[model samples]
Target: MANRWLRPEVYPLFAAVGAAIGICGFQLVRNICINPEVRVSKEGRAAGVLENYAEGEKYAEHGLRKYLRNKTPEIMPSINSFFADPNRS
Candidate 1:
């Protein structure tokens, strides 16, 4: 029967493939709708990146990245700094 072909062992493989396709689809949609370069260029594609690095930085930043930009790099600041000093002296 057709159900025989749907083994539990293959379920993870199917999920992985589906997730990859979904991520690709999301990026495609985001770039098409939200990326400034896609809309700004007169022709179909930009010949090169923007001449100004700051301008490109301004355009490329997403909401989550922007929000996290100012936060501390450490996940657990106190714990990390404590262990960071390897010297026991």
Candidate 2:
């Protein structure tokens, strides 16, 4: 009985049928059942953004540290004070 189903000519038809069923199942899940919004969360989105910003800031700080390593340290507190003053147009 099983040998009758395993014949070479019948095998291709069986494979094709299996493939069609798999595709139908996938399409049903994709188009009819699954909700897109449920796959994403606000916390996940915020974490992604925060990680990206942190990576960018880390690279910027590393580059600054490398460049400043050989440069003389100067009094830059006036720069800070100027920005802090805010009243300066």
Candidate 3:
């Protein structure tokens, strides 16, 4: 009976082959099904479906205002100090 499993160099070869197969499989799936699908919404309210730059800016400003209005008291000191820094260039 031959004991082929005793070879120490076979482990690296097996690992390399497994890594190659995994990478090739990942690339194949990414090329076929992982692509981004861009669909424009008729109602203009779906997530990640902004229609124009103006709408995006409006959303951003609204979000910032909401955050500032609801921010925690502990964070207020840091925020105030950042704006009050006269030496800021």
The top-ranked prediction according to TM-score is 1
TM value for model 2: 0.35
Q: Which ten residues in a row have the lowest lDDT in candidate 1?
A: 41-50
Q: Please, what are the lDDT tens digits per residue for candidate 2 over residues 1-89?
A: 98887889898898899999999998667544333322255675465434355645554566558888976565686786688787887
Q: Encode model 3's per-residue lDDT on 1-89: one tens digit a residue.
A: 24586477788998998999999998677545433333334443356644566745553566558777876666578777789888865
Q: How do the residues 1-89 of candidate 1 rate in per-residue lDDT, one tens digit apiece?
A: 86886999889999999999999999999877766566555563646654556645765886789999999998898788788878743
Global local distance difference test of model 3? 0.63
Candidate 3: which stretches are off by over 4 Å?
36-89
Which of candidates 1 and 3 reaches a greater TM-score? 1
TM-score of candidate 1 versus the correct structure, residues matched by position: 0.52
Q: Against the hidden true structure, what lDDT does model 1 obtain?
A: 0.77
Backbone-clash count (model 1): 0
**Estimated TM-score per prediction?**
0.52, 0.35, 0.34
